[model samples]
Target: MLALLGACAPRPQGLMRPVVAAEATEQGRSVDLLVATNRQVVADPDVRYGNRRDPHLHLTAVSVAMPKGRPEGTVQWPRTTPPQPQTDFHVTRLQTLTTVAQGRGWMRQHRRGGHVLLFVHGYNTTYGEAVYRFAQITADSGVEAAPVLFTWPSSGSLLGYNYDRESTLFSRTALEQTLRLLANDPSINQITILAHSMGSFLAMEALRQMSIRSGPLNPKIQNVILASPDIDIQVFARQFTEIVGPRPRFTIFVAQDDRALLLSRLIAGRVDRVGDINPAEEPYVSGLARAGIVAIDLTRIDDTGGSHHSRFADSPEIVQIIGRRLAEGQQLTTSDIERGGFVMVAAGALHTVGAVVTAPVAVLEAGSRPVPDISGTLAADPDALRTER
Candidate 1:
């Protein structure tokens, strides 16, 4: 009986474990955890595009340890449950990050050429919503880079509107610190940023602060893409003058038909300001033209929801443009805009006539923005312009 009992005795728990284990599992934490809540529209055309019945809120928690040495922009996605249709469309991740730009410590990593990509999400978004959006943008852009997302508390509750806005404001300082660290990294060559809706304001503020501390702007930045920003035009103009300098390539994707921005304008008590406004309609900061800032207006697309939100991820044309631009490192220009089948509103016609393109124009009515007096302005109606593209 003694011999038999000895044979049945179990080994210690630690002895049974493997010598090497994944960092997350070893720490008794999941490398990736997905929590999906709230029901929002997924816009899966086949699945009742705007059906609220489908779950829209999906959250992802990701914990990663920096690679022991310099990493060549290689990253691993978290292993989680099979993504649902709508849940799969959007990606949000809670990240464990180290601020490499804060001090001499991060300088070591910078010596290894460590770069970072920061993304800030917009309003009416849940943590899950932010993740998928980030993932889509990252993958679609072919940007194999470290991603750090600033996720403010966006209560999935619709009634939490005011709370969410307040929450975003609260998180700006923290986000700025993250950017500061990056700015100090000498080895880091470039920092790419993407901000959508309200996030644009937060990101701009952070950049503004960084510039004040560092002076002018670092040449390491490659691009700052503001998509469907939800800030007031006037405020953005002011912020641009204060923060952004003419170093990195700054591009704004505006859609005059953005209903989401319209809602944002209403909430902010601004009658005419959305992230995606026509540059021609409004005068930007004095240095804007010299800053290499390009604002492309997508008012010609009949985005089914009457919202520009879809352009960033939904529009095949925009995706193609973006993909080509990234793969070839090409900058989109007025010619691409013309070949894209959208007409530019001739600056001369701003007062007497509205811009008309081959496509049917749905949103850029005469009431939208008075045509500027600038010459060589091309205008296209939304319908006729995009029909061929």
Candidate 2:
């Protein structure tokens, strides 16, 4: 019955009408995206990876046009056939990589100073939606890292939530494999994960599996950002604890009024979802204070449209702040602007840092690779992305 609500609006299908023309790319700049998916490829060009799940992983290099003077944090999808490149995002170039080595070669070109940003998209998303959304985030944030996307087969139906959940469960191993492949490559130095919605759950589970089965998550995965995650608190607790030591730094974006997560909580036995946690409340506030984990609350911030589920991506201020920090390889703290959430004095400057700092453990597990001068010249033009990375 809940799923029927989506049936009312009837999502725009077959919008991925790729306009692969040389002049079409000339109309606007493009964000070159590296795509990896477990969704089965379709014969129809418009709906490339519809709703079907695939057993094997597929890799593609796609260049998506980014028109100028557009509002930030919005995807200008094509409403007509063969979208206008100067305004709508249209595909210019797409080539499937047949082998892991070929995929690595694609990364090698974008690995400016050896940093890569991998994105995992969330529930009720089509393959095209994931690609375009990631492209917007990458282009808007202006993060100077290679853009790689991992997309699982989401049914893209509002009512198909059950199928989407099971698909994520089925694709965990594939995601794990993709991570391992990225970590194993020699050209890649540092890796950061950006997982949205249910993708956050998938990311956590993959890391947990690695910790248990393969001993520990690769130290190369230095940071993880979970945006509007839809994971149950109890499940997240279990998943978080199972990840082995030398864990990466984690940042989570939360909001108290996230309607999508509210619905999620109701459906999942009335359990609290992490995305809706009120930072000032109970064990969450105190626990975050103690752990020194940064949880930015967006409950008070405005401009998140619709369901309030995508505050991290929708807000320009938040995106710029996060992108700049990640690009510089810096810890997320407060600035004068404070575009993101206010860092609660959880435990006074983070759960009494002196207590954890002064512990007699000798603090030797610092495993982050030396920050190579990864700057291949930050783009002066917002539209100019170097090497499509």
Candidate 3:
């Protein structure tokens, strides 16, 4: 009878068009819908691993409907707009699930009383990269709010520098608009942003523009973290001076040995912005005249030769600090800021501290080289590696 009734009902239209199939999982969720015209999924719904190696955006219908009675779950609502040829795209249900858990966690926490944590990925990141990074962040940050990722179309190719730059330019306006909307929404209590590499440019540009356009930032924003920002130091100073004015609560995480950024320097005719450190360059943050910037130095640590990338995801200490700050709203001290040791650095003073690297107890011996431990719980696990002693 239920099957006959489902067949008799009018077929749904557009992206939300529904189809019937045996329930996929008794313990899992299921979704069935159409893809907008031009948008595509970069992976096969069945094949999960190779999707990252060479993604194929599939223009098909996908939806996720969670089992009822859960505190928080997914629902496959009909999509409104048709797919456009240019840039609007969507991921498959299988792919999205692999990444949606973090966001759902955020939603659950927000319902209880938590803030939002937004992620912006750097130059060569794919959709999957953004999702996995957020998962790691939510798991590590200890923040309960929703995790939203702003994914610009990055080709994720080392040689696609120009293409990535173009995508950044094209996507800037949209990204800023989204930020503004989130800020103005009264229901939102707090917001924190963690941008990595090239994504730092986008994050800074948005803040600068918003500050210039609007007098001061929404008081709801707490932290503006830049991990391995790829912008020129002097340029950042000048821009912040004009836009933010003084006393901006920003944290810049820098490492002297960022190889990927080193490659970026070569491509830019050997520029210093590729993991170069100059703490004094932007001593004072804009909007706040006082020196409120937090500069963490990853120079002295073993860093596994390419330790710059480990700041956000790998180091247990850093993760613990940020997690405490976001979850508890702890205030840091000036001395602590200078040391950059804990979650709450000293407010009102600039901090320049050296990060402590904890070596793994077990080391693996490779043929010719010692493998660095890279097995931390977060996305970019530096300690999880089976390194040689």
Candidate 4:
């Protein structure tokens, strides 16, 4: 487990430096990104933000350029300084917003269709990792919203799991502040949260705080998408229950084959993680269906790098589905998935499995039809079920 986690750690330093040359500007695609983080600032321009906590929120506007014809869901990180943007993901520009008011004003002026997609990254991810990953997703998914990222102080070490988790707790209020600011903004029509792994825990806690303090979440805060959440199942249940009023629509992307969550579960005293649970099983199927949550099982889909935990953004089919359907605050239909065609390890075929009360199914046989009865869920529409208030 240590080796697995350590393998993904970025270089010790210097990947965040801005590349001044515009060689890739003409040929490569560029993505404008808005970053919100609680990471302490450092003097090194080569590595501006370090893994240290900050009491206040820091906002930065960045533009990452990707090489031409880069495939969906892939981030080609620069191998060396003065990155070749044609073959790597390079930061072309970086500007820091001195105040929260300035950040809000920037959003007001630049937001597209009043939509903002906010991403919260998972454990062991560095600042550069989170930035590049969001840029790749924004460029690949073709999501129409303004791309926003909320990064916390992560220790970025294999053995720093405890520190990383605690960092989330420390950074909770900052994130809540960011969320509240966005929620109250009249120009921002909707806020979509896409949190991965342990980041999902942070996102949930932020919403829970908002629910307890501000009454109900603002109606504009629409969808909360969790990708391979590393949250303890019971903790998640309580968090969801405590949020006492109207909340955002929740969609979970789960995979039984997620090795990262499997390791996380082992460290968590064998308690099942929300991400790796069998949604068709007793507690989860009933609880999720009861809560009106949509869980997309990607166990059979596979092929999401070594960890397989980032299947949501690493898989072209899955990412496209998110961009084309889920980003629009729309639920995915069987046909929507059929056109994208998930890359299943078993026979590599198209499958359809949609139910009234959404339940997790591993795969659908080719040419299959929706069978709500056998799916162990009884419902009329996935969007009809409201979260427990």
Candidate number with greatest lDDT: 4
Query: Please, what is the TM-score per model?
Result: 0.57, 0.83, 0.58, 0.86
Clashes of each: 33, 0, 40, 0
> Global lDDT of each model?
0.46, 0.73, 0.47, 0.76
Per-residue alpha-carbon lDDT of candidate 1 for residues 1-389, written as tens digits (9 for 90 to 100):
22321242231111101122334223221122222222233433221112132211222234322223212222222223322212112112332222222233333432323545667777656544455455554444444445555555565444555766666565554555445445545555656677777778777776665454444565656677778876766566556666534546667777766777666677778655645455554244223454456666666654543354656655544544554463233455555544643333223322211332111111111122222221111121111111111
- TM-score head-to-head 3 vs 4, winner: 4
Sorted on lDDT, highest at the top, how do the candidates line up? 4, 2, 3, 1
- Residue 372, candidate 4: C-alpha displacement in angstroms: 42
The candidate with the higher TM-score, 1 or 4, is 4
In order, what is each prediction's RMSD in angstroms?
18.5, 9.2, 18.5, 10.0
Compared with the true structure, model 2 gives a TM-score of: 0.83
lDDT of 2 by residue, 1-389 (tens): 35423433345445566675556434555788888888889998887776787877788898888776778888787766667666677777788888777888899888867888899998989998898888888888889889999999999877777898898887876787678778878898888899999999999888876666555677889888889988988777677766667678877777777877878888998998878876556667566655456676666667536677787888776777667785446666555224424233122323322211211101123233322222122221212212322
- Sequence-dependent TM-score of model 1: 0.57
Which model, 1 or 3, shows the larger lDDT?
3
Give the lDDT of residue 22 in candidate 3. Answer: 40
